[model samples]
Target: MLQLKVIQEVITLILFVVFSLVFFKNETLKWNPIIGMCFLVLAAYFIFKK
Candidate 1:
């Protein structure tokens, strides 16, 4: 279930960001975290690719 874990991680990251943004107005989103999420998405892509 490595694939499952990777997908879960990607979804978790997305939800975490959304939750933080919705619940914490004072906190600002930064480029670094976005970049990290992008990389995680890329990793998920490669793992699922055949």
Candidate 2:
């Protein structure tokens, strides 16, 4: 179960990056997506740190 959670988190992070990159390419306001993802990654890392 723990391993699955870790995998899900990693996949979520990757999707966030890909989504942000694709969004930014076509829209200017997509910066929020990238910033949001960065914060999410930071929070997730700290929260899950062992």
Clashes of each: 0, 0
lDDT (Cα, tens digit) per residue for candidate 2, span 1-50? 76567668767878766787697786554677668767766766776788
lDDT of 2 at 34: 68
Provide the TM-score for each candidate, comma-separated: 0.93, 0.48
The Cα RMSD of model 1 versus the native structure comes to: 0.7
Worst 10 residues of 2 by lDDT: 25-34
Residue range 1-50, candidate 1, lDDT tens digits: 99999989999989999999999989999999999999998999899899
